[model samples]
Target chain A: MLPGGSTSVTTSMYSDGMSTSDRLIESTRELLWERGYVGTSPKAILERAGAGQGSMYHHFKGKPDLALAAIRRTAEELRASAEGALGGPGTPYERIEAYLRRERDVLRGCPIGRLTMDPDVVASDELRAPVDETIDWIRERIAGIVEEGKEQGQFAATLDGEEIAATVLATVQGGYVLARASGSPAAFDTGVRGLLSLLAPHSS
Target chain B: MLPGGSTSVTTSMYSDGMSTSDRLIESTRELLWERGYVGTSPKAILERAGAGQGSMYHHFKGKPDLALAAIRRTAEELRASAEGALGGPGTPYERIEAYLRRERDVLRGCPIGRLTMDPDVVASDELRAPVDETIDWIRERIAGIVEEGKEQGQFAATLDGEEIAATVLATVQGGYVLARASGSPAAFDTGVRGLLSLLAPHSS
Candidate 1:
């Protein structure tokens, strides 16, 4: 509704109840994931969104502006979904396990994590911020839970929360790489189970 | 040399001692790491290699052909470097620690692992074989070490060799993602150290 949708009545852009801007953002997100920033063209976004030629110009300043919006949207969604497990009802290890075991499109890879490999995204400060912040936020959030686990005597007293949190984050981001390389999620699954095994409390 | 570099001249391609084919392959490897398969153009490869228009044509069939050669080179280099540690003198855990602690260009990420994220590479079986094989070989190699440790009574017999191997691979791959996203190598180092801590042998 915010993207000046009122100007286009003769040639509608929206496919359904969603606004023109919303469709554009969604389309851009998908393209960014599949084709990356350099390969994702303005024409592709318009065609994918089913919007007319000038619809993109009306909705956003340009590709960068639109891409920024899409990236932020993706970042927010990832954080929220991760919180579903991290902030859920369970012990710290159990919550971490749940996050690891949560459903994912492993083959498609992490939409945000993959962006780091895109030189265009990594080179631009604006483009890189969301990816950096999201990964950092996840690490910090995980560290907090790990700290709670330590404080409650649920984990080894020597386990460094920040370090363990980084391991968890890397396991997930790297899991996608392994899974994608092999054309199977088995690597990702085994990695998670292995980390869980290592994190399991020792019996006295 | 295998690419018919002998035919090249004043329309010259070589900058120094290296043959035109070697330069082309080397250039393709760097570009693929920096720009990815889809973003890396033939023109870019030629320019970086300091070769003439017909240089790439003579050396390799085309972009895909050159890319395959480059990918194989990178894969082979990676395996050799990893083997330096995995096959080194140490206990099973010590050898693994050596591999994890090996110096790497963390911010640049793993050259072979990054290829998996390239849609073009993932889509092509010929282009993808080296990446898949390299990853599988490393995983299997690590699993063998884990199995070795279990056999020697150095590790708990219950540990799954394959699962732990996957965890090691994921940590390195995902560690790159974290390091690049944050614009520093600290995350990568922390993740490795964290894993080492977890893997430190228990004192009886």
Candidate 2:
């Protein structure tokens, strides 16, 4: 795993009461985040989930099927987490600020964003769908907020909702890359600070 | 290779007269970008370069050594490419604009930025040195330009050089993630356009 990465999340996810199928899914999510689709192996998944060799096949068709489940679950979680801030009680700019300021596992990188870098994930349309949809969803959601901000004058009249939204999304996705490259979250924070300043209802 | 990636670069680098060591390094660079460090293997490198198996062993100490040389070359090239725009005749804002607008193989992503996602590359200090140094070097170089902009009143007085510099780098890095996710370069363009607007220097 990368520094400050998924070991505890993987370990704590398991409960004796958790169903075998749930274990399998959770384990896949963790493994996919840490190692990616190409680096993740069937043996590794089974070992991490603490499932019997045959348990995976017993629950799902195979690796790709199980991966789809994990990815969907991850996408849903990302959307929910993002909505918590984007949909919260605040002005458009403030709500957008809330989303940007929300905490993340910076050094370990974004779970869904990491899929974009995975050769196997990007190669399979089935796999890439959830990742692509979720990013679009987030961008669109943020664009909606920006649109609100533009109407209310928090943002400049010249700002394009889609463009500003894309910039907001890129700052985050790229912030993780910078943080991981240096093994520090400081760079990520600095980027966010700069972005917030730009979006600070000040004219440019 | 990716849909629009390194085959031509690799093919064009090799000629009958080129030394075995140079072929190995160039091939390593291409493979590393396409498959990353873990996915890249010695056999694959040789096949890509059309060099003998013995040629690798005869040239560098091992895969790690060759990777180091390849990464350093890549870093050097990235810095040189960046400086071409950054050091050109323009105001700080325009020079920074020149750097961001420079043509890139958008889908393939930034080669140096891609390495930060590699498990083997980030895990090894030796392999990661050049990648880390290059990103920092770029951030600092950009920061210097931002400082100049602040001094010349091209950017707002409140803007910090380091923070805005990190934002600039993050947008490019994150833009790649977004582009690769959608399998389109449009998101990257949108993000850059938004940034330029924010940096337009008119006021707040």
Q: What share of the true interface contacts does each candidate keep?
A: 0.84, 0.78
Can you write out model 1's per-residue Cα lDDT over B126-167, one digit (the tens) per residue? 998999999999999999999998898877777899999999
Model 2 lDDT at residue B123:
81
DockQ of each: 0.76, 0.79
CA displacement after TM-score superposition, residue A99 of candidate 1 (Å): 0.5
Candidate 2: tens digits of C-alpha lDDT, residues B93-178: 99989988899998888889888887777788888888889999999999999989988888988998898989999999999989
For candidate 2, lDDT tens digit of each residue in A121-183? 887899999999999999999998998999988898899999999999999999988888888
lDDT of 2 at B147: 89
- Mark the regions of model 1 whose C-alpha exceeds 4 Å error after superposition: A1-14, B1-15
Q: TM-score of the candidate numbered 1?
A: 0.92
Error of 1 at B160 (Å): 0.7
TM-score of each: 0.92, 0.93
In model 2, residue pairs whose N, Cα or C atoms come closer than 3 Å (at least 3 residues apart or on different chains), thus clashing, are: A203-B203, A203-B204
i-RMSD of all predictions? 0.7, 0.8
